[model samples]
Target: MNIQDKLSPTAKEIPPSGIRKFFDLVVATEGVISLGVGEPDFITPWHIRESSIHSLEKGITSYTSNAGLLELREEISKYLETGFSLKYSPQNELMVTVGASEAIDIALRALVSSGDEVLVVEPAYVSYSPCVILAGGTPVSVPTFQKDDFKLMPDALESKITAKTKAIIMCFPNNPTGAIMEKEDLEKIAKIIDKHDLIVISDEVYAELTYGKRHVSIASLPGMKDRTINIGGLSKSFAMTGWRIGYVAAHPEIIGAMLKIHQYTILCAPIMGQVAALEAMKNGHNEMKKMIEQYDQRRRLIVKGFQEMGLSCHTPKGAFYAFPSIQATGYDDHVFAEELLKETKVAVVPGSVFGEGGKGFIRCSYATSYSKISEALERIEKFVTPRLNGTCDKVI
Candidate 1:
């Protein structure tokens, strides 16, 4: 009578999230400065919080339609059109989801079947390959490198295509790496997708957090509107992660298929979250700008700190992370992260958890306060300096 004997193989096979494990370690350790989690440190904007409060005050805590509150969906449609020049019909082509995470899950489930292959660009968010496996698809890693700023090249993608390749799961303003694809880069990838007749799941959760240039949705590219599933939410952009609201925009056929799954699994996103999201769309722009400005400053500080410490750090143009190579320390990613945590009481995610290509790197989040980031940098510098100088066999 073993419970494990009856579990689904996929469910049993799935590994625990590496991010959560490090997060837990940080929580358990005393006096640790964590640059691990990718969540924004800012609270939800006042107006957005007020909207959710007002909704609760009015006794409006109930489920909306399975597709979500029509008002919210309409707002999402308008947000996309105004921001990215992408158009989606609120009625048939868009559905509110629990989070961008859920949208990704349902999109993969809807598009992939047994023996189907989903091209997952690495180093990607931890969820991508697991969700693909859960959906009965084989995840084929198309690795991108640090030298190239981790941008997914058309040649790399083209080489992986086979008749079984159904879709590509792409995340720009990528987690861990913080790499973003320019319009020209995406256009090239889009051309390859068009030629191969493959679909794309564009996870743009960090779209609004880009620094220098604006984010360009692949769905907005020529001939790409119908072939891409656009996923986004208020989590990264508006610091509303706890609100748990996200949405998906795709062609009617795909939306309709995803809706079938959503209806049964999650009838609707929380009504209060929808209200908060609606407020975020209408009034949170100014607040978001302020937060972005702060994140940009922190981004520069962290990347520069790592570079000055002998780590080859990439300047992230989007997202609040810096993936710095720890190769000079002569330690693999996991060892470096663990030793740094133990010795310096600083928590950062090991890049190896992201993908194989991430082995020599470490992902440091700059989403915390500026003062904390500066302090953490000082601490990290102290820890890695001796190792780089070859004066200490162990970094403590």
Candidate 2:
């Protein structure tokens, strides 16, 4: 019997994560400094961890409501209002998910049907396209470039829409590129979304991590609230990734559909995680701000280091990753990334895996320590300089 023939075609078509491909290599190689993973280097704060521990001690372990714990959802509601001026009803319009990842998955599945097409903004997070594919929808790339600061343009967006287009997935404070769409920038795209009558999945996992500008959710803009599915988490901002707590907010009917899938697949996010997340939402601000400050310092450091090494890097406005162009070294993104790992034991992801316009660039995460980032930059510079000098720079 052919096991390949027995498998779902969608599962076979999905590619493994480009980020994880290098991350796995880092794990296998000894003494590699990983700028590959996007996870924060910070531990969960004591108060948040203690709250969860205390809950466990009090025997508070049980399955939450299919939508998650009411108190946590209410706190999340307040968080949305305070942070983004966006309002969501905890009673019907919200759900606690496994991660922002699962929220993305279920939202796509809820909106996309066979023959439907979903617009994925590119140099995007690797998961969005695959998630659309798994939902039995066509994944269309709407490429954003470095010239535009990686922000999606209104013309670029509207051009991708067709009669079969069902939804668009957007991540601002974006992964890989670290690009953010300001309110005015989002307003243009919002008009196109409205014109097409399409649903939008807005991933704001990096909402609190911005440097100079406050994050403006497209959902907060006029007429966008009901058409948007907002996905968020305590993972990146609050350093609670391992806890697997995230939420989705949308129109009650849309959320009800996601919860139906959530009920069967994941009955609820863990109770301990919900309790810890509540503490983070309520009191984790100071700790989170401190982490953001350090990330800011690291972001500047990494960007400067790239420029010093003769690679062009856009200073990321938010999030902990830097997307640097390696075109100067005369090597494609994959070649540069692979040889950098093999020669310098410094791991970074090739940007090509992120979809259209990602070629000739790489993503370096600044979420690690200042000392490690410094050392990695040194290694990367040494690795690339000779290549720039027209030596057999590829020779390591």
Off by over 4 Å in 2: 393-396
Model 2 lDDT-worst window of ten: 387-396
lDDT of each: 0.93, 0.93
Q: What would the per-residue lDDT of candidate 1 be over residues 294-343, giving only the tens digit for each residue? A: 99999999999999989999889998999999989988788889988998
Model 1: C-alpha RMSD to truth? Answer: 1.3
Candidate 2 deviation (Cα RMSD): 1.2
Query: What TM-score does prediction 2 earn?
Result: 0.98
